[model samples]
Target chain A: MANPLEATVLVLGEQSEIFLGLLKKHFSTIYQLAHIENKEEFLKDNGAEIIAVATSNNVGMSKEMIDALPKLQIIASFGVGYDSIDVDYAKQRGIQVTNTPNVLNDCVADTAMMLTYAVARQLIQANTYVKKGQWTSSFPLTTSLSKKVCGILGMGNIGEAIAKRAEAAGMEIIYHNRTQKNHVDYQYIATLEELAKQADFLILALPSTGETQHIINANILDKMKPSAYLINIARGSVVDEKALVESLKNRQIAGAGLDVFETEPCTESPLFEMENVVLTPHYASGTHETRLAMAELVCENLIHFFNKEPLVTPL
Target chain B: MANPLEATVLVLGEQSEIFLGLLKKHFSTIYQLAHIENKEEFLKDNGAEIIAVATSNNVGMSKEMIDALPKLQIIASFGVGYDSIDVDYAKQRGIQVTNTPNVLNDCVADTAMMLTYAVARQLIQANTYVKKGQWTSSFPLTTSLSKKVCGILGMGNIGEAIAKRAEAAGMEIIYHNRTQKNHVDYQYIATLEELAKQADFLILALPSTGETQHIINANILDKMKPSAYLINIARGSVVDEKALVESLKNRQIAGAGLDVFETEPCTESPLFEMENVVLTPHYASGTHETRLAMAELVCENLIHFFNKEPLVTPL
Candidate 1:
């Protein structure tokens, strides 16, 4: 068995200082992928010694990178989503994978509710109106979220949390999932088309998979009510950005509140110029409290894997 | 008794078309205060014929204005708050007062929660950052509202509604009212100072009264944690604007989410420049759905008053 303290762990991306400190506490040899100027030479010389890899959803390990790490035993991701990581390839190699889930559910759910409220209530535009000395005149009345339908896609733990908050806001919940969930009493719509047609706010909370990529295409967009809002806190690939841009341009949908995009760290997009949409930089789970918990969980998973114990949240 | 359709109603301010339509349907003689350029002359000629006054919280009936109309039996206001109206003087004259209250609770509560989530999560700024093509870098982690103390002042219907949403968001609810109520399970802090000191978000949801004016002065603001936020969905007079400005300037409090202002339609203030605050133009219940309900209720109260029935929502 590899010595837990001496095992080389390759950190693939920039992480919080706290996460790095925790990683250092558990392992002596920590190699940052960014620090390696000649990656090919570095992997040739030292990749054999790298027993573990640490990454996040944004900076996922690729198949080529996985192939380079001959002795990679585990891939511990810092976020709930592992779609970016080649999980199937890792599984085929008998390597384990773990993610920091449940810890981020609250923050992500809060983001969904926040986005829904912001878009429906015109919070950002209203604030800007006030700041611009436009309050001297009566501001236009906005749409109310209360007593409206909140159609959730992917009725998972995070979606359930979002539903709880939405219900408290007096919104009725309906959802669409591959299989109906018995635990929740919220009405289940059989198809995405029905959910889109009925929803005042269609929130995307599903994972990113090959099947889910571009799930919200032009056809789905056309089914949504012109007054309905699209709130995406899920993986960006779930939505076809081109179709969304076209929808917004033509006023096919009222607006969107997006925390994720097809290409993350998206510097420019047509959505930026549209006042109807509210965009966040893929920051659904970005909070001081939640990030600390998620980072701690990632470290724990890595530590537990090296100790040959059960993984905290193995996928 | 005056004929139901013939009784004259003097509408004191601009109103929604729906409200005006309803009023016109009930009363044949409907006089708009704005159209009467010579109000004193017009009142001298026709005030005795005015059986009832229809006004709004913004344009309230003053003592002098009430005195002008000798036959006035009731004042029907279009909003929940009646602080702008001289209720005591009207009561002394044996005149009844009515406001649209219960109809607007949900939208106002929704606004309170929207402001809270927006301020705590930095939603507005985050949205702007992404729009400004600044998403190439990681956005800053914001404070989370979950597991934090939400201190409410004035636990009325709207306050209770706000508490419900806050609870769903995973916040611990504490409140300070004039006296502790037996109906609620939330902890009641007898004093305002203690609640301010303990709260992560100090939300003001009380009615505006003489005794409550400037209640959140420098002393109360000074008692608040620097990390705590102030959310005022109640009347603006409930807070001392000058004191709040000073507190925010000095970083004594984290931020504020203001839906009302001391002097409304206020075009200029130091707060306009502050990025830490989220300001709305006194539009808490300013949704098309809620405003229509409020307007209809105002009309109903007027109809009920002239018909010798109980007022829909008597103040």
Candidate 2:
């Protein structure tokens, strides 16, 4: 067992202060990668002493970085998605990997439902209409979610949570997963094309992997009804941004509510100008409550690993 | 019985073409008040022949207007709320009154839930942040609706519908109505003050009437938790707008989601400047599906009354 007083932890990139504070309280020696200048020199001096690498989904552990830290035992990630991390390399190196998952499912699901309503009802445009003093005339009527088909692309924990809310709002839920699960009652479409064709709102909730990358490309977008809306709370890699832009321009689909983009910190895109789309800064699970809970989970996973107990949420 | 071909129907103001067409199909002598140049001359020429008044909640038939048409036997309103119409006088003269209710409950409730999530999640500001190229910096974390208290002011059809959606989002429901409802399983509070103090989201879902006017005034506003949000999808008369603006300015309440204003077509207000508040033009039931359904209900009520059947939804 690694002693809490001696085992060093290296935190990569930016994280919430609460997470940093929790690490500080538990470990005696902590190094933040962001604060370290001249990374080569610093790692040469201190890398071998580091036992755990704390990171976020955005600042994932690369194979090169993993090779640099010779004594690294674990990689504790701060988000549910670990696609950015080279998980295969970590597994080959016999290093434990953990992520904060179930803690954030509700908030992420809430975001998916929020975007569904926001796009379907044109809430952002409605707010703009009122703020710009355009209430003298009636705003154009938008579509309603009730009795509409909500086709989910993934049926994981987050997808199920979203389905519950959509069902409560009088929306019918249908989904297309890699394979159908036995627990849920929602009808499963075997093909993604059929799901897109039948959906009034096509929501992407699957993980981003090599097989899933750019899955919702031109072919799938073409299959969707012109009135259908696309909602993506999943990773940005699942969509082809250029194709989505063209789809919106051509009115191939009604609109989109996107939290993630193909290239983020995506400050400039044609989507910014479109009135039909609602864009957020990749903010699914970006709530104080959920983030804090996630931070706590990340810290707990690290604490459990150091204590030689079973990892709370290990990959 | 009034002959469908001979009985005159006076449509008070501008309505959808679908409504006008529906009326035209059943009645040959249709007079649109907006098309008539001189109301006095038009009333003198055709008022006695008018056996029914077709109007909307916004352009309601007043006591004087009801008196103008001596033969008026029914006033079929196009919305659920008949507060603007002089119902007492209509009843005194044995004139039946009907409104399109139940049909709009789902859409209006969807609006309430959308605003609740929008306000709590800071969705509009987040969109603006991303659009303005501010995603380079992190958008601030916002509150989550899950595990929070949702205090509803009225437990009517719309309120119940909102409650169902809120509950599905992992929120606990507590409500304050004139009297406790019989069928609901949610906790009922006896006083509005307790509900305000306990709620993380205080939703106003009651109607606007003599007793309900200005119910959410400065006193109730002050009672709300500073972290709480106000969602008004009900009539604006139910809330004291001046007090609400003051509360928002002072941050007495975190923010508000307003679908209606005290005096609407409210082009000017202090709320337009507040980032925390989300303003939507009185659009709770403003979806194409619900509007058309309401219009159809209006026509059906008129048809049922003309045929000497019971009204579908009477005030």
Candidate 3:
């Protein structure tokens, strides 16, 4: 006989209203715990079989919250990055943890390339200059892309996408991944320090993990080419924010394009005052279509968990 | 025997100093005609073999000025768009016209993708939102490129580059060019009208010529999907400015990304006031390495002309 259709779901993350509408269709009664500051009260009131969380630089679920969820059978994350969630702890409790991946590869990769162009050509600064009416009679001659070495930290799906775009821009791709990415085609250095030494533009597209945190600290930055440009589309903790600000101030690196930060709504980073940096608010996959797809995948995972089928992207 | 260098190259463009340096090595002397008012005086002094015109959107050599340079053998334009130089009149005079081509393919293509991302994701507006300190959070989801049809007009070298990047972004590439491009294997349509009908994002990478001017008028835009976006890395004259402004205002098109303009320093255009549109100051080939490559190519072309060798990139 088939299992009874009586699984409760807890939607922990804030998402587009369109996504919330879709969730309501599958669940008997959707418990939106997004704005619920006292998550304990909400958790106690409405029991949940599956928990869904949207990953962001700010406001992630705590370890304590995971332990307290007695009825939580699965935790489905809205994005590929599940650094905020304790996957090991969830696995120990026999709770499946799943994330929306592969779907976000292109979206995240596209944004990384966007940031590269923005920094390489100073697109944002030029836009500001023209809008400010500083372009009295001439267009300023900005930076170029040809002949630059694009250094990638992670050679995953998104990092490879960035590499392809960089190759199109006449840049040579050099990378440092956790392990050999099964291809010996591109130039690969054993360490980040070695990769930084030869690169004209270094990009961070790695996932956030305990081993990867503060990988781009002052020591690594010191090994980078003097005229190099840095781009971080990966986790903020992967780069030391204070060291980056100092490097920008000192002109050790030519410029930077940053999307994610150690703390989001990153209103207080000293890097803000510098003209050489291009800042984006953790919007790698914040586009309408991509986010909606992520939401849909999370819903699918939830439905699959209740149906006793394997999750599409389970950890 | 090779003839001694006799041409007094009168460079009538701002930011021609580097090009002038290269020209001086081959020519007798170089004149930097910075302003339009000095045209008559500069032309009178330099009765030369060629009048190499360097025109950006802001700096253009007029037809009246060309009529004065009787000894001008060629108009070796600095960049691709020769709309500034009267190519038809030059052709009539048997003057060989040349533009630096193939060199700017990657750079311009990179800019096309940049503008596409900027407009589709509202990067500039988001930048403003963050800078104004109003972005305590991300806004409701808007646009994205995943699974959308990117309609490219004029599938020339730069267009192909843009197509590759867009395809990498998971957008389906549908292009319309005068003659089908032999290089790329992308899907091609015979007409702009048909291509625009299916596109979710229409990228204008066409040249500005008599036959091509105002190609993206109200009729073409009306055929586009209501949520479609427009990206122009080509000359601004190719688009009917007024029609675009109206389409954006009425929300007939979702937004636009304009790098070129019919009139630059375009402070008064309705497009400028719209938050939906992303504007760039024609920094398509604005990378440092690309600009230097373009400069070197210009020098080589000038040297080849004087030496009576076959032109490297003949117009």
Candidate 4:
């Protein structure tokens, strides 16, 4: 059913089946390049025909990959974070870049709150103890997360969402970011270290950026109270993994709840052996409903680009 | 080392070390009956001089135990729920009863909200997969908890606290209680079954009583949406463990988060092996700060009773 008039779309990496099915309806040729075993050769064979690049945040556009597809007109990514995509290079080439935003704020903020409670309550350890029949002999008390100060690292849309949730749970809200957020009534601490000092739980929710890199390293970790917890739902690049491991190992801080890691597929880490840490794969916004919405938005961005309509959410 | 004028208090069961330390400061003749090898012989040996009985909710005053303590003046319990204590028998014997309340509402409600998120997101399963390195291959998306109806089984203080937290997490609040709550705007579903049918999460926070025992039995569980979650932070006896097990096993309901069990020190149960259930071994109110506050209140009640002053929280 090649329409011949419709443009070609080159899916740069892994895309959900639902997204592919929807994209196929709009475009004449939708070649998922990842499905091909020889993707490098496949891209070279089809590079001349690829008018657009379809990918997710994880498989972001790079200079070399974009250079291969000289005819690339647009890049539609499937997440809020366009840090992975080479947006500057695409803009220089007169290519339009779009992303799915505002849609994932709810689920990601839910995860941040979930992690905050999970770590503070020692939930995973408590579950393990009950499963192992240790409660029959002894049970230890955990710290209460309610009525404590929750320091958010970023005061973006997601951070505001988390604050609303935390405040409703009876926790005081404080935040540290590059600049103060207007409209929010929460207390603002200028420095990350000061925010760490005031909080019982320090939650990281900032985007991955050069300026924000290692924002929570040893210096900031040391400033945190020994009774406090660390929760990261944002990118792992914001935290110094080695420093966090050392701090957790030495009991410099209480514990952590991590959904992302410094490296993907974190097969080996000292954190895995620690009882205090609650770890999850990079799936903070990975909800059945939210992911489908994001996938649809990804398709919509591309379709709008082809239809000469204004992009729904252009980066 | 002993205050001769102080009342002789009989310690009924094993107490926490922190609670014991605080109790020892006020009372002179604190005879810990649990330390005795033969409790029957010990009661017979030294039951006459016991002016007051100091115990927790688990080793509550029974009719038989009350009959033995002919000189008992007051019973100071260490937890909010005095369901285990024979209040009627105590009243008949003119023995005053006091319990710790209000101090644990925040932590207990936090547990309710935590359980809600844990079960809905399949948090425990997600953590296991990431820890086991299965994330390297694949990870499935979880269900979103936001924008769902959270049905609180009882609109008591703890349930209200849970409502506030759930609302902050972007959930609609529905409630089923004996009567409608005043000063709140949340929807009220008259029947428990109706509430269960409308809810995405049904959290149990009702006090355990003769009227409430097995309140969430088969019929109510069956009325619930198959995709909904059950969160029990109240007494475990309210839920029929056997019926819940059956529903979960057959996938009649999606999942459950249980903080208490019918028989604690539950050494054996099919629940321990279930993937969809998150068990926490009666640790809902197990927070260091809250327990300390509860412990302090227990001591204060005894002190007030001995001083011929009014009890702080009399039942």
Candidate 5:
């Protein structure tokens, strides 16, 4: 006598053990896999009916994998970014794709502000100095946010949140989004170049797509003030890594605080060698509270689907 | 004729070279005789009428130096911690004492939130593993901050600000202050012990004073939830460093995020050896914009005093 709730769940992305454990609680016979390069192996062995894919910009699922899953009814993503899972492809197969959105807004926003603070105050560098016993007399006097301009690119939920925190710190807020948001207090600009030229601190919060690729390149970097700082908590591909490295090297920009990079598990990036850059391994929505909420949301979405209920925060 | 503005200023404490350059812009004579173990040697060489002292808990100004400065009319301390400076002595001598107060409030609050996010998500530890080239495979599992109580000690300006940010993150706010503040919308507790026992995360935002010393001791730690975390961005002396080290060591507490310590240049502290604690050199308000504003405030105070006007933030 098999349980009526038994569903074969395929988890494609890595999650916190807590989250993974929670997923197992909801769905029976759960199979976990990270970057399933061999699609044939997954299809032949697991017999997955419902796939829950955890997507990041670094690791994405291929189009071929979707076609092979005969019993796949839903492609549940753990996060807002479905750039990993081909939405159009999944839609064509009568497969419903869902993502957890609006849950990570504050966490991502907090991370943006944290990166900005980390770079402006030299927290990471100072900690490193203290750890390395490099205290000759004192640490170099770092910058403050009392009179700085915080330029936010992509005036979405995360950008707005970062602006709120930065504004509370007495920073003048200016933003450059694709379209001007209505009834906003922040000064909006049409072009990234115009925003870069004006801002002392530029934050990239735009989603990554074809139009956004290499958005922050040599031409844009040239427009930025010499003392300006760049922070990217968004997708890594939105920035030109080589131009950023060159700008930091030539002192064209004061520094950069990067959470994401062109590659994940960044082992040998030139940006790491530069002291001006604070490199984090793309952990914008990384918080205990936020992650749990995200996991619960994923679980709720799966539960609703199984019970024939409407999706909450559908992609 | 000598320029009337050519003033000799006695500088105290450690300053960033950039900030020093800013100070030099206003005053002609900058006497940087920091760490003057020999009071007589410092006073004899620098015949300055105004002294700017910046002292932390470790390196404070001695009573002897204050007596030696016969012509000193103003003693402008570097930071808000005028506890190191004998304000009463200066007041008795009809000397004005000014400290940088409101300028640094926002930055400190920002750092508090930064530590809160970093610890909650295990960003520092996760990043450390990735940086050390230990990422053999993807490991997923992180703590979430949803539906948790954040107990704050000392609901001052910074604490209130942290509360606003925490509330935005959907955390339940409980606080213990000397007296309840009317402006904030948070649950108030009469004592820290009550707050500590209930909170999933206990944050120390109280000042370091005689009455508040070692307030978060072993007894208090014993009462706190075993899964709870402790964060201190306030003065280090407010929490018992030894008790905290043992709490984390014995797994009595989940983790700690500390910016300040019982001692500065805290190289030999046992907390550093543990993986459960996230330690940063006392740099809650170490942002460049904030530092410059503080420096400007100091310069303005000196200007106002010399002109026979009231000080901006006089003690």
Candidate 6:
């Protein structure tokens, strides 16, 4: 007794619990690829019926998977980053792609600010010191973050948010971007190496692309001040992870505050061994409120696409 | 024959190594009170010659010690807070009391902001989770600090600095002060209880006074929203420790970010076991730059007092 107009959407990998319920509430048919006993048989049977794919950037679209879905018309991604998606391939196939954006800016900014302050204040080490009963003597003095020059690499929404917070905390802001963003007064550096050298705290909020790959490489790191710290809330591909580990080891940079890793879940790395750096499991926009907002946006984007309206945030 | 201008200053307790060096550099003669192997014998012989006393709040000027130093003209305290000093008794005896202030505001404000963000994002637990290799799974979503209402309890220089920083981070400003100040844009809450009720984060930046002691008591804590947090950087006596412990245990308030405690060298406490609060060993201004500035101020205060000039920061 299913409606003939009800098209099945293949969910690639496990979606969030919130998203599952929401997806069911809005869509009549659901096909979770991970739960299928035999993917080849299930796809062979239901491939023609599948008109859309709902997935996160974590469980991305692949070329072979795309070929399996003969009737697939759209891909709705949960996260803002679309680096994992083969956009060119999707475009050639005329597969429309949509992503959730802007809804998670506040929480993502909070995360960036959190990491910046956490690394600078040595909160991780200080907290451990207090809990381990080692506060018997006076705690050692750490460097001050106030009044330092906060150099933002990408002057996007998240970077502007970080700058606003850093400014409130008495830090001066300078940045390096592709082109001068109009209607903003923050100083801009011409090159990445110069920006790295001058920044007291260098933060990356750039999107990932082929040209932007390994942007924070050995040369840029070598140019950075020994006292400087780096914060990455953007994609992991932006940084040269091997070079970063070496710089952190040699104290070429004072420390790092990272949310994304070159490879996640960074189960094993030299970063895990260092006390100077803070590692987060790529959850910068991981708050319940932001996630809910993002999930809602994803659902809405899918709905809007099916209704043949302009997408809320087209990728 | 002793030179009147070259005052013999009594150094009480174990002073900071930096302060000890600075003290000796500015003053011609120094007497180490703690190191005087025979205290009574030494006092009997040299007490009358002690023209000034240099001590921290920890080694406060006891009434008996003040009586012993008959020639003491000034008390140069190393830290800003003069709560430990018997200021009235010193005033009665025509003795000057000077403390270092303003020099520590930037660092203190930094500490307050650090705690606010640390508690909001659960930085302490996050750090521990990553270090213990438990980040194989995603970290749970914590609260966002951006756009929250930051209600400052005291609007002094340190509080103002905190406001400026919090404002830049997109937090709305509100405050509860004894009286309304001129030329400030933040909304004023008339009563402390109401302020606590409205705040997402209630920060204590007021000085410790007889009236201000236990200002954040059980009754005031009862008025706070369940989602709100308390940040104490002012002094421990400002909050009722028992009430705070109970509130934290019951989740009456979300959490606390504490840098000051009711007692120094806190060997034991139930708070040590709680994961919701972040604690520091009362080192809000514990940065090299700020400490050095404070030390220099202490030396300058002593030098000014001996030179018969007006006390720089008289208590």
The candidate that achieves the highest DockQ relative to the unseen native structure: 1
**Model 1, range B221-253, lDDT digits (tens) per residue?**
999999999999999999999999999999999
Model 2 residue B260 distance off true place after TM-score fit, in angstroms: 0.4
Q: How far out, in Å, is residue A243 in model 5?
A: 3.2
Q: In model 4, which runs have C-alpha deviations exceeding 4 angstroms?
A: A1-8, A25-28, A36-50, B1-5, B36-49
What are the per-model numbers of colliding residue pairs? 0, 0, 4, 0, 18, 1
What does the lDDT come to for candidate 1? 0.92
The global C-alpha lDDT for each of the candidates, from Candidate 1 onward, is 0.92, 0.91, 0.77, 0.87, 0.75, 0.85
Q: Can you list each candidate's DockQ?
A: 0.86, 0.84, 0.56, 0.66, 0.38, 0.58
TM-score of chain B of each: 0.97, 0.97, 0.89, 0.95, 0.90, 0.95
What ranking of all candidate models by DockQ puts the best one first? 1, 2, 4, 6, 3, 5
Deviation from native of the Cα of residue B125 in model 1, angstroms: 1.4
Runs of candidate 5 exceeding 4 Å displacement: A1-24, A27-61, A69-73, A286-289, B1-61, B69-73, B92-95, B144-148, B164-170
Model 1, stretches more than 4 Å misplaced?
Answer: A1-7, B1-6
The residue-by-residue lDDT of candidate 3 on A1-315, one tens digit each, is 233235566666675675676677666666677777887776776545444433322335567777667766777777788888877887887878888887777778877888888877777877776666566554667766667788999998888878877776678889999798876477888988999998889999998999899989999888887789899989999998889888888888889988888887777767767777878788888877787788788878888877788888886
Instruction: In angstroms, give how far residue A275 of model 6 lies from its true place.
Output: 1.9
Error of 6 at B280 (Å): 1.3
Candidate 3's TM-score on the B chain:
0.89
Which is superior by lDDT, 4 or 5? 4
Task: Compute the DockQ of candidate 5.
Answer: 0.38
TM-score, one value per model: 0.97, 0.97, 0.91, 0.94, 0.85, 0.92
Ten-residue region with minimum lDDT total, candidate 3 chain B: B49-58
- For candidate 6, give fnat to 2 decimals: 0.59
Interface RMSD of 5: 3.1
lDDT of 5 at B308: 77
The TM-score of predicted model 3 comes to 0.91
At residue B253, give the lDDT of candidate 1: 100
What is the Å distance of residue B90 in model 4 from its true position? 1.5
lDDT of 4 at B128: 87
